[model samples]
Target: MASFFRSAVSPSSHPSPQQAAAAAVAAAGDAAVKNLSSTFRLPFASLWSQSAAPLSGQRAAAQAAAAAQAAALAHKEAAAAAVHASRQSTYNTLFTILAVVATILITEQVLYRRKKAHLPGPTWTIPIIGKFADSLRPSLEKYQAGWNSGPLSVASVFHIFIVIASSNEHTRRILNSPMYAEPCLVASAKTVLCADNWVFLNGKAHVDYRRGLNTLFTRQALATYLTIQEKIYRSYFAKWLADPSPAPTPYMMHFRDLNMETSLRVFCGDYIPDEGAKQISDSYWLITVALELVNFPFAFPGTKVYKAIQARKLTMKWFEHTARESKKRMAAGEEVTCLTDAWVKAMIDAREGSDKLADESRKVLVRDFTDREIAMVLLSFLFASQDAMSSAVTYLFQHMADRPEILRKVREEQYRIRGADLDAPLTLEQVDDMEYTKMTVKESLRVKPPVIMVPYVARKPFPIDPSYTAPKGSMVIPSFWNSLHDPNVYPEPELLRPERWMEGKDSPAELNPKNYLVFGSGPHYCIGQQYALIHLTAVLGTASVLMNWEHEITPLSEQVE
Candidate 1:
C-alpha cells in the first residue's frame, strides 16, 4: 500500500578570529614591547621579581581549569556524533522502505494503465483504496459520469482494478464471452457464499452444474411453484389490511417480506415450517446489506458480513435439514410436494433406471446430490433473488400506483382471466394470457433495474473492443442502466410506458431484441428469469384484483435510491 535545520558554512577566503589574533602577535614581536617606558623599568623590575612566584602559581591554576573545560567540550562533541549517527540510521531505513513501496505502487499503476490501452479512464489510479468511498455510498450521478465517458472505462478499489463496459455492444460482448471472463460477483462473495458453492463454478464445471439444476426452473416446475406463490401473497395482503399503519408507510420492507416468504415457500414447500420461513426472512436482510458493491472483506463480529454469514449458516442448516427429510420421504415413496422432493425423486429415478421417470437427457448426469450440495444450490438461488426480487416488487407496485390507468388495465386483465373468484390460484396459461400485466412488469423492471451492474473477472486478456483488452485477473463490470434506458431503443425511456412493449405496431423499440436486457443476454444470463418475471406479474396482478391500494409520492420516493 502507498501509505510524510542548521548550517556552519563559511567563506574560504576569511580567517578564523583565533588565527587572526595569533598572526597579529607574531608581526608585533619584542621590538614594539621595548619602546615602552624604560625609565620606570628599573623600579618595576624589583616589584616584578617579588611578585613572580605568586603570578606563576595563578597562571598554573588558570591553565588547569582551561584543560578541564576542553575535556568536557570534547566529551559533548563525541556524544553529539553518536546521536547524529543514530538519526542517520533511522533515516536510511525509512527511505529504503518508502522507496520499495513506491516502486511497487508505481508498477501496479503502470500495469493497470497498460491493460487499459485506449479505454477512457484515469491515467493513474488512486493508491490503495481508489474510489472505495464513492462505491461505499453509491450514486447514480457518479455512475452516469462513467457510462457517459465512453463505451468502456476503468476504476479500482482496494488494489482490485475494474474495467466497466457501458455500451450495449461491449456489455453484451462481456456477458457472451464466457471463455474469457466469468462472474466474480464481488470481493467478499466467496466468503459469504462459500468457496465450494456450485455457483462459483466456471467453464465446463459451471455448465454441467447449471444443467442439472436447470430442471428446477423448467416450465413444468414453475407451474407447480405458482400454487405455493399465490397462497402466501393472499395471507400477506390480509395482514397488511388489518395492520395499524395504513397511512402509506414505506413498502420496500413489506415487499421484501413478501418476496422472501414467497421464495421460501415456493422452494422448500411444507418441508419448512411457517416459523422457519419467518426466521429466515427476518435474518435474510443481513445478507442483502452485506452484498453491497464495496464491503469489509472479513467476517469479524458485529460487521454486516459477519451477520450475513451467520444468517447464511442458519438458512443453510434449515435447507440441508429439509433436503435430508425430503430424501427420506422420497425413499419411502411419498409423493413430491416441493422442489426438494422433486429433485430427490429425479435423482432416485435416474439411479434406479425407472424408464417412465428417467428422461434420456437426465439419465446421463443422474446422481444423488449430497444434502450439503442441495442446500448450497438452494441458498445460491435465494441469495441471487432476495434483494433483486424485492426491488422489482417494490418498484412494480410504486409504478403501477403512480399510474392508475395502467393499473386499471392490469386489473381488468386479471379479473377477466381468473373470473369471479379473486382468490383462485393461477395456472401457467392464466399468467401467459395476461399481456398487459407482463408489459407492466417489464416496464417496471426497466425503469428500476434490480441489479445496476454485474462483475466479471478476466481469465485472460479480453479484447472486448479493438483497442481495449482487459488484462488477466482484472474485474470487468457491464452496466445495465444505460442499456435498459437507452433513449434510442425506448423513446423517452425515463417514462414508465408499458405500451412500448405491446404489439400495436412494429416500432424500433418493440422490434429490437437487444433493447430488452431485463434478464440480461447471452450464455450466463439469469437462469430463473422466467420464474422471477411470472412471480412479479402474478403478485402485481393479484394485488390489483384483491386489494384497494394507492401509491403515496414522497419527496425522496421519486428519486432512484
Candidate 2:
C-alpha cells in the first residue's frame, strides 16, 4: 500500500504555536474537570452509603425513626409525582428530536437514490458520516478495497456525496472533462489556500489564469531558479551532516524544511531574509496538517483549521511584502534575481517588443496583479506542491539509500554532465542531460507517488459513461494509483525500476502515456510538473555528489499511514 506524502511527514516532530496552545488548554481543562467531578461524586456516594445506618440510642432512635418514616412517606409521595411529570416531559422531547432526525435521514436517503440512479455504490450511506470512522485512521489498502469493488464507488461525509473513480477510463474522463468538473478540495481548503487564489478558478478563467502563470515555470524560468535551488540544497545538506541526533532519526522533517527553504528562496529570494525562511518553514507544518483530505469545516479556536489559517496569514504577509519589493525593484529597472523578480520581469517583458512576450496565444499577458494577488498566487503554488514535493524528496533519499546501484547510476550521470566541476553552477543543459537521474525521479514518484488523488466537483450532469451520471455538486475524485499501477501498463508496477521509463516503445511504461498521471490531466493538471521534475533531478543529482545519507529501516516505514 502507498500513502500521500503530504501527511506522511509526522506532525509530532514540529509542533506549531497554535497546536501547542490548544494542547495546553485541553490538558488544563481535562485536569479541572477531573478534579471537579471527583469532588462532587465522592461526597454524594458517602452520604448515600451512610443514609441507612442505625441510630446510636435505641429508645430515642425508635421515636425518631417513627417520625422520620412518616415524613419520608410524605416526601416520597411528593417526589414520585414530580418524577412522573419530569419523565413525561423528557420522553416527549426525545420523541420530537428522534422524529426530526428520522425525517432528515429519510429525505437524504431519497435524494441519494435519485442522484445515484444506475450507479454502482452502497445501497444506503451511513446516516451522516459514511466511512468517517475508517477515515480517522486511513490506509491505502482500505481505499484500494473500495476501488476494487467497482469502476466507481460512492460515499458521503457530513451529507456531502462523493463519487470516486477507480478505473483508468473513469478517472481520466473526470480529470480531462473540465467542462463538467472543477477542483473542489475539502471544505477547509478555501480557508487555507484563500478563496480568491487562482487555484480555485474554473473553466475559462482557470485556463486563462493558468496560461499567464505558466510562464513562471517554463524551462527558462526553471533555469533561472536553479542557481538558488542548488545553493539551498547545499546549505540544507550541510545542516543534515551536522545533525545532533545520536541515532538515525526520521529525516522527513529535514527534507520538508529543505523543500520549504527551496520554495521560499525560489519564490521570494532576497526579498525574504534567512530568518524569515526558517520561521515560515517551521510554521508550514500546521498548514499541511490542516489541508488533509478531510478536516473539520469550522475554524473554531484551537482547531487545526484555525492554526492553519494563522500560518497562512503569516506566510502570505511575507509573500505580499516580497511581491511589493520585487515590483518596486523591477519598475526601477533592476536585474531579476529570484522568482518574484522573474515574475515581475515577465509582466514588464509582456509590455516590451517580441522577445519572450510574443506568444499570441495569451489573451492577457501584461496585466498588472496587486501585491496581495501575486502573493496569493505564490501561496497557491506552495499549497498545491509543498507536501507532495516533500514526500518525493523524502522517498528520493530513502530509495537512493536503499539502492546504491541506482544511486551510482544517478551519480555517474551527474558527474558526466558536470565534468568534475563541483563549484560550477547547475545549468539547464546539465539538468536535461541527466536522463538517468530524471528516470530515477520518475520511478520514485511512480512507486511512492506524492499525491494519490485529485478531488474534482461536478458542475453539471456529467454523463461519465453510458451507465452512470455524476451528480452535480458532488466530489468526483480521480484516483491516480489505479492508472499509474496498471499491471499491463507497467510490468512489476510496484517495483522501483527506473529503466522501465527508458526501455523504449517495447516498454509498457513508455507506450502508456495516459498511465502516467503523475501531474494529473486536463485543465486543472499541475502547471508546475516540469519545474518539479527538473528540481528533483537537480537536487538528487547534487545530493548524490555532495553527501551520503543512510535510510534507517523501520517496520512501519514501508507501511502507508
Candidate 3:
C-alpha cells in the first residue's frame, strides 16, 4: 500500500522493487551531480546525462558486432567443406579415366601380338605404324617375298587386314569367290573417279552393269575402234621420225601420251574439241598419280583427293560434252564413228524399233541411257584402257627393241600386210587378218600384261577351299602374274616367244583362258577384251611397219611406276 501510494505521484514515475532501487540510486546520483555542479558552478551534470544514452547505444553496437563475427565463422566452415567435396569428386573422375585408357591400351597390345604371332610377315612389324613405311613405295621383289611367305598369309596395319593369296588355285579361288573378298584399290579411287562411277559398283549390280558394257566392245565396235587406232598410230609414227637420231629416248612417256590422245579421239571423235582433248590428256596424269596403292583421302585444298577431284571434274566435263554432241549427231542419222557415237546410235536404235541388244548382233532391251550414265560408261572405258593400254604399248616397244630378230619378223609381216607407204588407214577386216601381229600382241600381253592383278569383292563368308577360307571383308588380292607366268603351262615362262601360242600343240585360246586372267576370268571380266587386243594389234602392227624405235632401259624400266 505504501509503495503504491508513493509511485502514483505521476504517470512518469518508475516501477516498484528493482525499479525503486534503481530510482533511489538514480536520485542519489542526481543529488551527487547537483552537489558537484554547485561546487564547480558548471553545466557538467547535463553533459554527463547526454553521454550516458550514447554510451548505452555504443554497448548495443559492440554486442551486435560480436554476434556477426560468430555467424561469419560458421559460413566460412560450410564453404570450406563444399570446396573439399568438389576436389574429391574431380580426383575420382580423373582416376577413372586414366584406368580406362590403360585398360584399352593393354587390350589392344595383347590382341595385336596374338594375331601377329601366327601370321607370315616381317618377323616384327615397325611398331604401331606396321608396314606403312614399306607400303609408301612398294616393290615387285617385296611383293614376291610376301607372296612366297605362304599359300595364305595375313598382315594387319592400322587395323586393316590384308590376306595374300599366293598359289594359282588360291588366287583363282579368291577372285572367283566374290563372297569373302573385295578389291581395295588405293584410298584415292573415290577421289580420282567419282563415287558414282560403275567401276566401284559391287556384287550382282557390278556384274550386271559389266554385262551391259560387253555390247559396247562387240567385234564390230572393236573393229571400228581399230580403224581409229591405226590412224592415230600412223600420225604419231610420223612425229617420231622428226627426231632424226637412231638412238631412242625413253619413249614410254611418249607412248603413254600417244595412247591417251588416241583413246580420247577414239572415244569422243571430233565431238571433243582438239584443245579440250589435249588439256584432258595433259592433266590426266594427276588422276594416275593419285592412284597409288595408298594415299591421304582428305579433300582439303592441298590434299590428293582435292587434286584428283579437280581432274575428275575436267574429265567429266569433256565426257558430258561428247555425249551431248554424239546424241545430236546420232539423232540426225549420221554414221556411228567413235565410241561415243556408237553408244548414242545404239541408244537411238533401241528407242525407235525392236529392242536393240548391246550384245554383238543380238537385240535385247531397248533401254534409254542418260547423259550421266553414258559418261560413267565412258569413264569405265577410260579406266579399262588407260593404264592397261599404256603398259602394253610400252612393253610392246620394249620387247620389240630388245629382240631385234623378232622385230625384223614383225616388220616384215606388217610390210607384207600393208604397203611400204604405211600411212593408209587399216580396215577392221585387215586388222583381224594379221594373225602374226595378233599373236605377237597376245604374247606380249601374256609375258607382261598391263594389269598384273584382278580384284573382286566377296558378297559373304566364302569357303574358298578345304584348307583356306578368306575372312569376310578382307582384301584377298589375286595376282594373275603367277598364273600367267606358270612354268608348267608356258614351258619357258620368262621367254617372250610368240611361237609357243602358235605351235599346233594346244589351242592358245582354249588352254589359256584359265591361265590368261589378263582380262579376268569370271563374270566381271574386262568387257573391252576384244577391243583392247584389236587396238593393240593395230598400234603394234602400224608402229612396226612405219616407225623404227629403240629402248633406253633403266633399272626402273621393268618396274611398275
Candidate 4:
C-alpha cells in the first residue's frame, strides 16, 4: 500500500505502460486545469474590482444628482416666496400713500368750506392756490365783479382766506376796529419794509411812535419843506421847457424822477449826494414792483423781492449815514433843513425842555433813536409817499393839459395868489389860500386814488357782522374804489369835477367824509394828509405859472390801467 501511494504521488517515477499512459492523460488534464485557473484568476479579480469601483462611482453620482435637484427646488421655492412678499409690500406701500393723499385732499376741501361760511365767493376754491392767477394779473373789472358780488365777499390765495369789505360801513369798520384787526398792507409789505418797521407796530406802541412824528408835519415844518420843493419844481420845469423833443413824449417817468428827487431832498437834503439820489431814484421802481398785492414769499436771488431787498440795503446805507451826519450837525446847534434835522432837533429840544413844540398833544417823551432806526423811519416815509405823490403829480399835469378851461382857472388862481411873481417862494398860507387848486387836487385824487384798498389781518375771530365772523389769521381787505365811486356819494361819480368840492356845506361829497378814502381812514389814516395836500397844491400852482404843455389824446387816454 505504501509502494502504491508513493507511485501515485511521484509522477516522475517509472511505471507500467498502461499505468504511465493513464498517468500522462491525468497529468495533462491536471496541467490544463492549473493553466486555465492561473490565466483567469487575475483577469476575473480585475474585472470584479473594476466593475465594483464603477458601480460605487455611479452610486456617488446618483447621490450628488439627487442633492443638486433638491437644492434647485429649494432655491426656486425661496425665490417665489421672496417675489410674493415683495409684491405684498409694494401693494401695501402704494395703498398707504393713496389713502394719505386722499385724506389730505378731502381735509383741504373740508377746511376751506368751513372757513368760507356764508360769504359770496366761488362755491369751491381752486385747490391749494385759489385766485393766485387773478392776483398775478389783477384787473379793475375782476375787482369790480368781486366787489359787486357782496359787501363781504370771500376768496383764498395759497390757502389764506380773504374777506373783502366793499360797502362804506364795512370798510370803515375794518379800518376803525383796532381791537380785531391791524394793517397788513399786502402779503409782501412786511418783507419789503422790514418786519420791525414802526409802521408795523400795533396798539399803544404804534400810537406812541406816531405821536413823536407829528412834529415833523406841523405848519413850520411844511414851510421849510416847501422851500426845498419850490427849488426842485423850478429846476424840473426849466428842464422840461429846455427839452428838444418836438413830438409828444411820455412824461410819466420824468414826473416820477421829479417826485423822487423832491422826496429825497425833503427827507435827506444835501446829505444824499446827487449821484446817490439818482441811484436811489432809479432803483426805487424795484421796490414799487415788489410791493404788489402778491409776490414770491422768499428773498431768493433774481426774484423781485430779492432785487427790492438789495435796493433797500443800498438806500438804507445812505440814509443811515445821513442820519449820523444830521445828528452831529443838529447837536452843534445848526438850523433844521431836512426831515432828519427836524427829528434830531425835536429830540434835543424835548430833552432840554424847550417850549418850541406846537402843542401839548403833539408832545411826547422823545427817545434818542439810533441811526438805523432813523433810517428805517425815513425809508417808511419814502415807501409811503413816493409812488402816490408821483401818480398825483402826473395826473394833475394831465388833467390841467386836457381841460384848458380848468387850466385857465388854475392859472388865474395861481396868478391871483402870487401876483405875476411866479419865481417867488411859496408858503403854507399861500398853499391854503388857493382853494380852487386844492379842489383840483382833491378831485384828481378822488377820480383815481393811488391806493384802492388797504389790507388788514384778523388778530382773532372777528364778528365782522351779526351773521359772519372772520376767522383768525384771515386777511380783511377794505376796498376804497366802491365807496369813493358810489353814485349816491357823488352824482355822476365817473366825471372829474373839481366844482363838487366848491359846492359848499350841503354838497354830497361834503356831507359824507367817510367816502373819501383816498389817503385811507381811522387810526392809520395818512399822517401826511395836510402835507400831501400842500405839496400837490404847490406843485400844481407852480407848474401852472412856470410852463405850459399840451396833452395829445390817444385812444388810451381815457383808459384806466
Candidate 5:
C-alpha cells in the first residue's frame, strides 16, 4: 500500500481515493499557511509552514519567510519615519512660540522708545511691566526726581505711556487746553467710579452738568451746611478727648473718620445711618488704594480694584436710597438740611417755576434726574472732597501742633472771631471772619497739597510744547507739587507760612495763580473750592478753640505715606 501511494503521489499521476485525499489535505494545509503569512505578515509564518507541511512545503515556507521579513522591515522603517516626523513637529512648534515672543518683546521696546522720544525717563524700559515696581510703591522723592528731570518727563507703566508736565506753564497748558486733553483720573478711576460718572464727562456735557450743579455750593448752601458741620465737629472732638489711651496714637484714621462723618452729614443729612456711614468710610480706603496711577487691569477676586468696586456698590446703594428719600422730603416742603435736599429742592422749584429760583443759571432744566443720577452726583462730591479734605485737616493739625506759635495765633483768631462764644452755632459770617484760619488751611494745602498731581489723557496728539508732542491716547499728567513748590514762585515753599497768602495780590503765590494749583486749574478745577475752603476753615477754626491736641513726633511723623 505504501509503495502504491508513493507511486500515486509521484509525478502527475492519478491515485487511489485515500492517497488523493491525503495529498489534498497536505495541499490545503500549505495553502492555509501561505494565506496566514500574507494576511498577518507575522515573523513566525515560516515555523507555521514547516509544522503544517514539512515535505512539499519547503519552497512555500521559504517564500513566506521572505514575505514576512520584507513586511517587518517595511513596518520598522515606517515607525522610524513616524518618530522622526513627530520630533521635527515638536521642535518646529517650540521654535514658532519662541519667535512670536521675541517679536512681541522687540516691538514693545521699539514702540516705547519711539513714543518716549527725547524725554527724561529710563533709556530702555524694563520690558512690558516698565516701572511697575516703582509705581506700586510710589514715593514723593522719586516723583520729585522725575519732575526735576525736565519740563516734560516721560514714563511707561503697563504700556501706558505717560508725559509728566513739571513746569508751571506746561502744566497749566495741559489743564486749560481741554480741546487737546481731558481729566482722566487714573487707570482705575473709571473702573472704581463707573464710566458714566459725571467727573468722567468731557466737553459740553461736563460743562453743562457742572453748571447745573454749581448751585449746590452757593453761599446759601454753604450756610446751611455749616450748621451740620459744627455739630459733627463737636461730636468728634468729644470722642477724641474721651479716648482713654494715655499714649499718643495715630489720629490719621481718626481725622479721616471725622471728615467722612462730616461730609456724610453735610451731603445726605440723617439719610445714612451710623453703621452705614462707618461701613462706607471703612470701604472708601480701598477705593483710595486702588486709585494708583497704574494698577492690575483685571478686577479679579481679592484684588484692589475688585474690592473697591464692591465698596462703591455698597456706598451707592445708600446714596441712591438717600436720593429717593430726599426727593420725597423736598416734595413735602420739608426744610432743606443737606446738599441732596438743596439739590432736590432746586429741581422742584425749577419744575414748578417757583419764585425761589432766583438765578436763572442755577435752575435745572424741566427734565428731572433719576435717583441713580443724583446718587452719582453726590458720590462725585464725596470722591472729590473726601481724601483731599482729610489730608487738609490732618496736616493742618500736625502743622499747627509742630509750631506752637502758629497754633497760638490760630487760637487767638478763633477767639476774636467768635468773641468767647466758642459753642455758638457756626455761621457763614463766623467762617468768613476767620481769615487767619483760611490762610492756614490754604498754606497747609500748599505745603502738602492733598492732590499732588492731576492725570489727564491726550484726546489727540497734544502739542504740549513745540519740541514734544504727546502721543494720542497717552497720559499727560500735570504735577502740582513742582509748581506749588517752585523756588521761583514761593521763596520758601517748604515752610508752612500762612502769612504768604496774606500778602495780597502782589505776592508771588497770588501773582502766579497758575502756581497755586491746590484746587487745580482750567474748566475741571475743583468746583467746590469755596466749599472746601469754608469746610476746612470751619473745622480748624472750631478745633482751635473747642479742643486742644498735640502731635507726638515719631520716626514716621514726616513720612508722607
Candidate 6:
C-alpha cells in the first residue's frame, strides 16, 4: 500500500500540480464562506430590528382579550338602549290608554247633559239630582206648571223618568197598554193596602181574580147597593143643611168624608161601628197624604211608608172585624142585607152547593174568601172608590154651584123621579131615571177629573210614538183628558156640554166607546164602576131634593196643585 501510494503521490508530489489543486479548493471554500456571511448578516439584522418592539404570543392574546372586553361593553350598551326604548314604548301605551278612557267618560257626561236640556223643565237641573227638589215638595202649582210646559214633557225624580201624557189619546194608550204599563199607585199603595191585595195582581192572576169579583158587581148586586146608597145620601144631605151657610167653604174634605162613610156602610153594613167608621174616615186623610205622587219609598221611621203603615193598622182592624162578623153571620144562616152579607152568603152557597169549580158560569158561585182576603178586597174597593168618588163629589158640587140653570134642571128631574117622599130609598131604576143628574156628573167628570192621569209601567220596551221609542224601564203614560176634552169629540172641549151623550153624535159615540179611560179600560178596570155611578147618582139626586150646595172655586183648585 505504501509503495503504490508513493508511486501515485510521486505524480501529485510535483509542486505545480499540488499547488494548483490547493489554490482551487481554497478559493471555492472562501466563496462559500462569503455567501454564508452575507445571508447570515441580513437574517441577524432583521431579527435585531424586530427585537426593539417584540410581539410575543402572550401579548397578542392580551390584545385580543382587551378587544373582547370592549365588544362586551358595546353589547351591554346596545342592550341597555333596547331596554330603555322598550320602557319608553310601554309608558307611551299606558298614557294612550288613560287618554282613551278619559275621553269616553267625558263623552258620556256630555251626552247626558245634552239630553236634559230640551225637556220642558227647569232651566238648570240640580246637577245629577234632577227634579228631586220638585219631587220632595209636590205642589199643585208646580204640577200645573209642568203640565202647561208642553203637551208632553219628562222629569227624572229618584231616577224615575216621568213622561206626562197631557193628551187624552196618549193617556189612554198608557193605561190600556197594561202589557206595557202597570199602575204604580203612589208609593204608599202597598202599605195602605197590603202588598198581597188583588189590586196589586197583574197579568193572568189579575184577570182570574178580577173574574171572581165580577159577580159582586152584577146588575142585582148594584141594585142593592143603590138602595143603601140612596138612603145614606138622603141622610147625609139633611146633615149638610143642619148647619147652613151662604158662601161655600172648600167642601173637598167634607165630600171626601161623606163618601168614606157611604163606602163603609155600603161595604160593611152595621159591622163597622160608628166610632170605627168615624175614626177610619178622620184618619184616612193621613193615608191620602202619605200616598203622594212622589214619596220616600222606604219603611224607615218618619217616612211616608211609616205613616201609611199606621193608617193601614187602624183601618185593617175595622175591616178585619167586619169580615169576621160577616163570616159568623153568614155561617149562622142570617139573611143577606148589605154588600158584605150578600157576598158572604154567596160564598157559603157556592162552597156548600154542588158546583164544578172549572165551570166558568158555575164559578160565578162565590167561593169562601178568607177574612183577611175579604178585608183586603174591601180595602181594594175603598182604594178604588176613595179618590175617584171624592173627585166626582167635588165636581158635582162645583158644577151645580157654577151652573145654577143646570142645577135647577137636575133638581126638577130629581123631584119628578122621586115625588114627595124624598126620604124614601131609591130603586136602581129610579137612580137610572135621573138622566140629567147622570149627564151632569159625566160632564163634570169630563171637565175636571179627580185623578188627572193614570200611570202604568212598561213591562217591555215599547214603541210608543213612532218618533221615539220608550226606553226599557221607562214610564209610558196615556191620558184620558185628551179623549174627554178632544175638540173633535166634544165640539167645545172647554164647555161643560152634557147633550153629547143624549144626542148620540159620532164624536160622542167615538169618545164614549173606546176612548173613555175614566174607570180604566182593561180587565183591571174599576170593578165598582156600576156601584160608583149609582152611588154618585143617588147622592146628587138626594142633594137636589134636600139641600142646596155650592162650590167656592179657587184658582188653585183648577190648577194642577
Residue 48 in candidate 5 has what lDDT? Answer: 78
User: Per-residue lDDT for 246 in model 1?
Assistant: 56
Error of 1 at 488 (Å): 2.8
Q: What order do you get sorting by lDDT, best first?
A: 4, 5, 2, 1, 3, 6
Measured by lDDT, the strongest candidate is 4
Per-candidate Cα lDDT values, in order, are: 0.83, 0.84, 0.74, 0.88, 0.87, 0.73
> How many residue pairs clash in model 1?
0
TM-score of 3: 0.78
Worst 10 residues of 6 by lDDT: 354-363
Native-to-model Cα distance after best TM-score fit, residue 393 in candidate 3, in Å: 1.0
lDDT for each residue of candidate 2 in 1-561, tens digit (9 for 90 to 100):
112322443467776886667666666776777888899999999887676454435667898999999999999999998999999999999999999999999998998888767666778878888667777888988888878888888877777788898888999999889789888778789878888888888888888887778778777778889989999888888887887776878888878888888888888888889887777887888998887777897799999999999999999989999999999999899887887887888888887743776474234667788899899988888876788898899888899999999999998887888996887899998888899999999999998888888888899988888888878888899988888889999888888998988988877787779889889888888888988998899899999999877877887777765
- Give every collision pair in model 5: none
Candidate 1 runs further than 4 Å off: 1-71, 355-361
- Residue 340 Cα positional deviation in candidate 1, in Å, after optimal superposition: 1.2
RMSD of candidate 3 to the truth, in angstroms, is 7.7
Q: What lDDT, from 0 to 1, does candidate 5 have? A: 0.87
Question: What's the alpha carbon RMSD for model 5?
Answer: 10.4
Candidate 2 stretches with Cα past 4 Å from truth are 1-91, 113-121, 244-246
Query: What's the TM-score of each model vs. the native?
Result: 0.85, 0.82, 0.78, 0.89, 0.87, 0.74
Q: Estimate the Cα RMSD of every predicted model relative to the unseen true structure.
A: 17.9, 32.7, 7.7, 4.8, 10.4, 13.2
Candidate 2 structure lDDT: 0.84
> Cα deviation in Å at residue 73, candidate 6?
46
Worst 10 residues of 4 by lDDT: 358-367
Q: What is the lDDT of residue 287 in candidate 5?
A: 90
What pairs collide in candidate 4? none
Candidate number that wins on lDDT, 1 or 2: 2
Candidate 1: tens digits of C-alpha lDDT, residues 1-561: 000000121233465786556445544543354544465686799799889979998999999989989988998998899899899999999999999999989987887677667777777878887888888777788899999999899988887889998888999998888899988887788898899998778777777777767777777778888888988899899899888775768888888888888888777888788888888988988887887878897899999889999999999999998999999999999977777877887788778776634364374437779999999989988988888898889888888888899999998998899999876678899999999899889888989998888899999988888876788899999989888888888889899988888755588677777857778777777888998988998888888988877877777776664
